[model samples]
Target: MSHSPHNIRTASAEARGRGATAALLIAHCAGMLDLVALPVWVGAALIGSMGLAPAQAGLLVTLFLAGQVMASLVLAPRFGRWPAQRVIVGGFALATLAFASLFLVQTYVLMALLHALGGIGAGTALSCVHGLMGRSANPHRVFAMAGLALGLFGILVLGSGPVIVEKAGAATLFVLFALATFTAAVAALMWLGQSQSVAENQADSSAPTSTQLKAPIPKVVWMGMLGIGCMSLANAMLFSFVERIGMDRGYGLQTVTSILIGVGLFNLVPPVLAALLEKRLAAGRVLLAGPVCQLLLALAVTQVQSLWLFAFAAVVWVGVMIFTHTFLFGLIARLDTSGRALAATPAMLMIGSAIGPLLAGVLVDASGYQGLGLMVAMVAVLAFGCFLRLQWATDNRAAVVPRSSH
Candidate 1:
């Protein structure tokens, strides 16, 4: 049977959309391995195999996050100029090599360098993914899908990672990361080329040129980035130390591990809920609530001595971050039509994450767990303030929500 020309075009577009979604999901799952499995990679493995002090381990992780922030800042502005497919494929391939190298390295300095290099590669790929998602019909929906994928990935790694690390050794975790990234790169090669074609076909005359892309990002976008970054800072500051806090309060290892596992399991729900409520809830209003909720949770986790209370707060913490950040991501996507600012998503996130552990350590040393809670409160206020400023920008311009079919 012969198909109509319009039907053929529709079918082809659907096929391309499906392909792009698959590529984004796979690449996001792989690129976010470090973050989703942070407790395993940073807390457990580094202390166990590398024999580093908690501070050293934290610093090492910080170095890796610093690399991500640095690479994102460099690449995101030029994202429009570069070929997205090549950048993503090359980035993951580089990360594959770096993660593999990590399995062989033992010295702290060598390990730190390898971690940084791996972070750079992973960050580059992740930035491009954000850029692509921003350019899609519904950035919020696409990002929510990615978040759901990451949550599932988190469950698998968090549930199994400790056992694997215990049995096979810390270095095996690096091998797992290498395999994940290698798979992502191979998958991108198979699928992301189609996404590139779709992007090119969708490009408009107003699409930013090299010269325009090089121009400074606008103030509103920067504000959104900073707001998101502040939320990340508070989340990471407390999250990095949650297990330690529980143990210090006399919670058993078994209980702490169970909380982490619970966190992984519960992580699945928030993104699904966010996706469902995308149009029902206003992103701007939700953005304002995110920081406040983060502060309250941080305080609960740190100040609560009861095992149940602490566990509940700790488990919900990262999930809230995921849910709230999804809206912020979509909002920023709308604010930046060129997709360049959204491309810097990694930088905004990692800058805060990079500072979080170091700052938490200092605060903990200076005062106590309460000190960390105080820091979260301060950061939360900053985040709320930034989001508040964004209300005027969004309210004044109704065009922020583009007229496109989701």
Candidate 2:
């Protein structure tokens, strides 16, 4: 798939615009960076590394995805008329408040409450940061930035957070995270300017200039959401529980953690490559891999129990997850040039994300890690079947469009 340099001119204009887009992503996601591993790292320190149960630790992510679902479903639309910056700032403010509570709150209930709030903040921030990416002169560059950020944070959390915990303790980490998120939120509003507001951005540039306006959803787009959802569900299940899976199998907790951290390095590779191939492969080509990867990885799980086997499975499996996510966003942005409807796509992805984790949790509670992995693998099979149906439908639709117009 031609995912990169779609129409790249070696000229400075493209390069300059890319620089500006990366700056915007960094500025907007600062809160994200500031608190990257704060919750888990801090929790590990305060709760005692052994004190943090796998399910409990997984809940932190689960709750966050739940908030993302609720926010995406409820809050996102109401703010459709606001600037993307408003959401960014509000998310940061909320995250800061949550972290501030962490500085003192010690009860599990209290931590859950704050984490739930932080998830909402994370959901809002992610949705908006992604929306901002839609405005880039080169959308792939923005995707690359996102991949870079996620990878960097993974490194910080998996690698550096442990060091910080060893030296400074959890409370100190909370205070630092609070400061950083607050700074990011402030910077987003100040630097992005007011013109980037959602209400002001209704001009439909993606449509033919002579084309009549209609509500933005095309059948193709909804189908795209399905694929995206499947990809994220796999990612959430794997990311939140992969360590649990490894540890249960006999690896040391520290070794499993290190393996998970090593994941960040690969996470960086896919988006850059996907962006390069995006133009060459239609968005569907990239998204179609979601189910394909899931199908193989699911069986792969049955075969491989060793640490190396899990690691090997992760490489392409993670790529499939990243492919679905990155391309889904790219496709949604293409379909809805108007900033408002486009905003919902992130929320949809989050919704899928929430479902995956909750299901994983339920399965784990019932059957343990191996069973949970198999259940997720089943879901992947179902999602792949859906992808095949959608692919056929899309081809049929493309075939009919010319005849219908004539």
Candidate 3:
């Protein structure tokens, strides 16, 4: 009852830190949900509600993702200079308004415009989130926490999104997207405001500030980003069509929806596993293996006729990307302590994601699911090559350290 003023100040600062962390988690989850719920957004809303052809629907999603890539690329370099609170609040508010506007628009052109606007806002917020993570004391674990939050969000989206879209129509789903971003914006406004005490505490917990934020990112970090982009491309290429694949294979709506739920439930693993194995596992080997696993799974899900096999492959397809990308995110954070490279995380991931759906759509229309597999095979080859180079660079760096120390 007789606490000193210093003790009270410390407690308040700790509370603000916790609040900031919570805000970050919510922002990360909300900002990333479009990519997370790709199957529903692309398959159900665009194809089912809007009655767009596969390639056309894919193009709509591609436009949104391209906007995200462009915004993140433009904002990430300035992330260190801008205030995080303003970026997050402004970005999510714009996204919320854009998503909410979808309820009033029916034309494909109008919807596409809104989607691109929403993507720009979401991408700006995401850059801030990733930049904060990169500057954290433990980027790997922080990114893992964000991934873990996304897993929970994914479960809700996959579990309920189909039912909601089925009952209330696609407009309702867009409304929900607006609601999610609005929540993040409000949370950021309340918790991540430019409070000096919170800022000081965050700075204390962050990595050293000696790194020049404007310095060019190292080549190894660029390779790592390329590896992530390829993996993301391969992932979204098949994932955006998981529901359609099931339907095309003659699976009933109920059965496919159940399998999608299974996919969400299974997604809860990799981030936790990555956090646990942060130091124990070899990142290079995981990076090398991730693309191969993704390719095999893509082929399995695409080529298999068996209901159980397809369901199993679809359920676990995203986990490998989550696991490998966690390590890659951490690696890039270490390589580029300035945080600019990590701030471009959305750009790195979404550039390929933007291409994935349209490319897959073209392939599927031309040569069927088997053609999609071939495309994934080619992308996986590029991913493997990038990761191989990353591994070599990491090994060379490790070898040089001991010699330089001596």
How well does each candidate superpose onto the true structure, as a TM-score? 0.91, 0.79, 0.95
Better of 1 and 3 by TM-score: 3
CA-lDDT, candidates in order: 0.81, 0.59, 0.85
Candidate maximizing TM-score:
3
Clashing pairs for model 1 are: none
What is the per-residue lDDT of model 2 for residues 12-36, given as tens digits with 9 covering 90 to 100?
A: 3345434435445554344334223
Write model 1 residue lDDT over 1-406, tens digit each, in one string: 9999988887876676677668878998887775577777765687655566667777877877888898899998787777778988999998899989988978888988988998899999988888888777777888898889888888888777767877888999999899999988987887776335323335431245566566676677777888989988887788777766876787766777788888888888889999999889998889899898998988888776778889999888888889988988888876666788988989989999888877876687688899789889889999999988887777766666555731
For model 1, the stretches where C-alpha displacement exceeds 4 angstroms are 1-9, 194-216, 397-406
lDDT of model number 1: 0.81
Q: Per-residue alpha-carbon lDDT of model 3 for 295-385, expressed as tens digits?
A: 8898888877889989999999888898999999888877777888988999998999989888888888899888898788789889999
Worst 10 residues of 1 by lDDT: 197-206
Per-prediction CA RMSD (Å) = 3.1, 6.6, 2.0
TM-score of 1: 0.91
Query: Which residue window of length 10 is worst by lDDT in model 2?
Result: 204-213
What is the Å distance of residue 10 in model 1 from its true position?
3.9
